[model samples]
Target chain A: METEGIYDVQAIRAQFPILSRKVKGKDLVYLDNAATAQKPLSVIDALVHYYSHYNANIHRGLHTLADEATAAYEASRVAVKEFVGASSPDEIIFTKGTTDSINLVAYSWGKSFLQEGDEIIISSLEHHANIVPWQMIAAEKKAILRVIPISDDGILDMEAFKSMLGPKTKFVSVVHVSNALGIINPVEEIIRLAHQHNAVVLIDGAQSSVHLDIDVQTLGCDFYAFSGHKIYGPTGVGVLYGRRDLLESMPPYQGGGEMIKEVRFEYTTYNELPFKFEAGTPNIADVIALKAGIDFIKSIGKHAIRKHEEQLLEYATAKLKDIAGLRIIGDVKNKVSVISFVIDGVHPQDLAILLDNQGIAVRTGHHCTQPLMHRLGIVGTTRASFAAYNTLDEVELLIQALNKSLKMLL
Target chain B: MNNHRTIKNIEQELIDDFSLFETWEEKYEYLIDLGKKLAPLDPAFKTEEYKIKGCQSSVWIHSFAKDGFVYFEGDSDAIIVRGLVGLMITVMNGQPAKEIVEAPLEFINTIGLSSHLAQTRSNGLRAMIKQMKMDAGAWQVNAENKTVE
Candidate 1:
């Protein structure tokens, strides 16, 4: 299980400058990777390079800097197109983040496609981003929002999901991985079942893209969305991979210059596929920098990174399971490198404060899934999410810190 | 409820007590103990109606006035936040409406736990302080109106 020699985790750690910094007079053992990853130097350098050298407005400028900037931005689209295995660059739409991407699909595609009394099925595992947009659109359209319930262990009740699908089922949007529990949903099966009912599926890959190999065509989901920041890239940038025909059919999310081809006093012709969805002056610097993140992942390979993280998850789970009062939530076979747990008689916030005092950073509370917390019958949990850069030593530190924090709390 | 000890006196006492603890470990351990020893709030007042909106952990604050002195009782699901609530009650409880309204509560910073109660995190400590002051202010206005009548 030791991946130390082949994975070169220290070398991976070296690429991230923030990894070496002290948080509270101690070396920062950042276990909040599921929240947002620390950027590698390549991603940072790409951001700096764009602003310093080719800082100009994109797609419209005739100047040299504009041409350079535009090319880099579009080149990033191709990188993302390849990253998600989209059929064409046109299917890869740049968005603000996963939330924004979901909103775009809901507002644009949902408005266009959803009918009265149609059902939009989402799961209990989804973050608010996947849940709320569908609810809003459903409310507006007088459509129904059906929830795919989870089992006691946080796995989606696939049989219940299958039963939930019917003639009224128009859309199936769910998280590929639970942000709160790190339980990987059976998205492929969900997609297949929903497709049988002719339901368009949107996978919220915000948590999965970092760990799994994504292939949009193979998965056959109509839309896939993930945030760049979660994948060691810059924030304010994400990708929404829609089927080309679906993108062409949907209305523009907003009325802006980039989204239009030609505007007249009476009528406006919208821009083609991806640009139609990209409404405003995009996060050009971050989008271009996102390409560097993709390249970094490609350089190291996700298999190697996943192997290293899986080892960390396994090690941490065993150590955490040894703690008497600690109970791990949703430790299914298909989970990623995230561990969510609650300890008896220890408030998560109190544990977080004490752990943070020892320079161990972990996420506390509902983790943006309040309903999931309600289902689990707890107010919140303390979650330690791993990344490619995290190590076994850090996991041991977390265990030691948890033990010390628990002593003070109990 | 100590009539001789003003809010300022309680503040000074808390500062002196917190000063004894050099590290956050001792400080937090003391806080957890303070939280546990804190009296359980009336179960009826622990509902959403008394709940403070800002905290990640649920906090409920209930205040009432008797004999022109405002009394406050609060509780939180999180022990650390409950400790903070206990501190607030110690300083503000059984004070005259005006005294409660005008209490300068800067001892939290001196105790080195200000970040836990920061307004940015929307921690219950800040919101509870605001609500307690507002309650005191309302009580003061009501008392003044009664005198005028």
Candidate 2:
């Protein structure tokens, strides 16, 4: 349990094979961790192990391979459950990703529970995945979608959020961390305030799950959803943790094989807890491999990982700030390892292309937060996000690349 | 000599210019330079209606038929994409409508620019090319209709 060498980023970097690869004849400097973290060797090996050994349909198979597959899949659920500090594995439903999880709640729960003129609250910092689902549900149900605004520094306006919540506020969904700005919202406070109004709160933890230690129990959020890929797991799999009673109350998200308790000509009874939301055969290998991703995080303690990332963030921020006419989008105190900035004369896409040509990977766009970009009064920003494996050296490379590219551009 | 400059000549010139750079970085710098030197489109023509679809960045390309040749005014929010627009314009602008429609534009591939550019940028470039061709095709049809009239 001793995380002695967890902060050794060089050791961590070796675990990701892609880190050694060359892009455009130079060393690959990946800074797009907020989009998707590169999988460690353990996670990759876990995937190959599952597919090579026990590739079979999970749950209801009496055969040995099926049993193995089912065990591994369910074990991943337990790993996710423990990772997020959820009370039980049954509370965790395997989802496609954060988008699928949000859509599941929006359609199944929102359609059943939301009434006309009811209010659903979301923050301006939310990714489109978090925003569009509520918007669709609101339009369909004739409910109102209220947005909590953010300040110039990208922190959510808590006072505005509190004023928005009332007797009519039926649901409140917010992002735990802003993917675009990297600002960590005050979700615990938001959850507490929403619960006071008897509103169900769903936290979009897509960007936070990798960087921060999460405890659904402590946070007291009704629903917490995040993507596996963002946390160094495979692409198709994700987790949606909901309160047991709340999950039981909502109807089945999809009615198919695994989600059914009994199928009758008249009506079919739904399965219990998590299975009620999961339909048909899931991403068996990916789900099984997700446990390895979680284990990878635990092996190198979250605290240690956070420390390393904070160092990288600080180093990168200072280096980037030193460059004249380079304006960072969000300068919030509580933020993850994401830095979004706009140069005075260079377009984000151009910067991205130039950096990419130098074997440096960075995301340049609205980061799927177009409304947030509009609010910030910019078309897009060039974002460099770090993972636990990222190092101070890579940060230096990014700064060097940016400086070189900007000089050529300006 | 300038009056006889064809779309093919311009594409060949671009290819020659690009071939001068040994490294991708140098080529990119040259591209940015090209983008910087591009004549700015009139603000009035940079409207959404004139915007080219399929581009990640906002690219406006306004085409008009003048003296039997198609003239294109182009701009983009992204400098690299604007440079790409400038490249496209350099090849197609002031070319006869028939020649514009018929031009192979193999120079993009010949210069290895197609392979060098990102998929989205290539797609956007193709979209711009398609739009220009469509504009030329329309003008060609209009000319034929006038002759019939």
Candidate 3:
């Protein structure tokens, strides 16, 4: 219980019961936060509460359970809207996850605005969710998909990005933080430059949402996308924050029960901003539970969490560098708490298994960013991403496990 | 002596050998050692053509038949996977192509590698097993055709 500087990490860790669990006869040192964070008891209870008390269809239901469910569901929307600093609750459109959120924008907006030969710019650091959706749309629209290259260190070549932005650049989709490398991209400069070309900008905040303070309004990007599961919330729920004007202008993402204003044999008009995109019954339990995740973040405050995580990151970076034959990719100053590294003579997959035996869960593979892996000139790197709950002691445990694992591997 | 052994005998031998190790660490160490000892595939066959799909690491498994018996030469960039490949080769190697194809590979369970390989993350090992069976099946088809001819 290192209760230093008003940031009680041990207290925070206590809230998540999974932290006390074990794997392979050892205490679970879960480091795979970048994949999906473990939910807090608060978030888990929200799901349980929803199912137990008021489990019913939302929006159109006239019954008491429906009213309670709808209230809780919409309350989450307002929470998300406030959480991301969107202009209004209408700006927050709930979807499956970041992938679904990005697809909503790419499918709806790209189909309407993209012309042949139009250039859509995406950085090299983007997750597959950010890249693939735009690529699909660009291909269908006969638009060119221009990629912003990265330096050997995995930092985005910002100057090259500036030169690429022009009247032809119809869209600029980039990640706030690289999930593969954890390098925070120069998205602020990117947004300003893309706006000069009148190109729409989308920030894939999937990796950044839980870590970075996200003020979508301050970001001035046309759209921001993130997943709830990454932020200690439930899976199958994500947010797409589009500017109200932009959201209203774009067509509905999916046409179904909730998305429709009226339906007749003649014609059917679509619903308003958020609901227009939220088609069908939506993930009722998860969406309501997502507010608890948001509240958990709000309770601790992002600044305190960020400060604590930075400590863990600094400690990890310094210690991981001490390991012989270990190379930290994208070891930049400005980054999140993720440490993606490759050790000589040891495959990342091998490290993943040996670490699991030691009860240390880490991510090993391309992390759904194969293009980035290709650029890095490696098969894959083992990543150990930290959450706010992660402590310096855990980082030391990681080092110890790595040393033990490497003994067998090397 | 090698020609006298059946696939069942080989599988039982593997289970017995693995039963000697009481701990997961010892089992993994054994697997890693076996992987290192497994015959390397020809560099030419190490290309995408022979590479096992769905593996986290690159695993190239080349199969051939000699005197109606199937032999497998496999290697993996990841030692654990290579070790799994080694285990597969141990069970099926030197068996008749028809027998190799028909072998249930129950030793994976008996040896306690089933739970370790079951994790979707280690899908490479599962994919490797499927590939071994498939390669042996191809040789079985060829042997059957030769009999028909």
- Per-residue lDDT, model 3, residue A179, is 95
Clashing residue pairs found in predicted model 2? none
**Ten consecutive residues with minimal summed lDDT in candidate 1 chain A?**
A1-10
Question: Model 3, B88-145: lDDT tens per residue?
Answer: 8888887887787677777777888777675545657767777888888998888889
Best-to-worst DockQ order: 3, 1, 2
Interface RMSDs of the predictions, in order, are 1.2, 1.5, 0.9
**Local accuracy of candidate 2 as per-residue lDDT tens digits, B34-142:** 7888999999988988888643588888989877888898998888888888888888988899999999999978766675463655337777888889989999999
Task: List model 3 lDDT by residue over A207-228, tens digit each.
Answer: 9999998898788999999999
Clashes of each: 0, 0, 0
TM-score of each candidate structure, all chains considered together: 0.97, 0.97, 0.98
Q: Chain B alone: TM-score in each candidate?
A: 0.92, 0.90, 0.91
lDDT order of candidates, top first = 1, 3, 2
Docking class of 1: medium
Query: In lDDT terms, how accurate is model 3?
Result: 0.90
Q: In model 2 chain A, which range of ten residues has the least summed lDDT?
A: A1-10
| TM-score of chain A, every prediction, order shown | 0.98, 0.98, 0.98
Instruction: Assess candidate 1 and give its TM-score to the true structure.
Output: 0.97
Question: Candidate 1, which segments miss by more than 4 Å at Cα?
Answer: A1-5, B1-3, B120-122
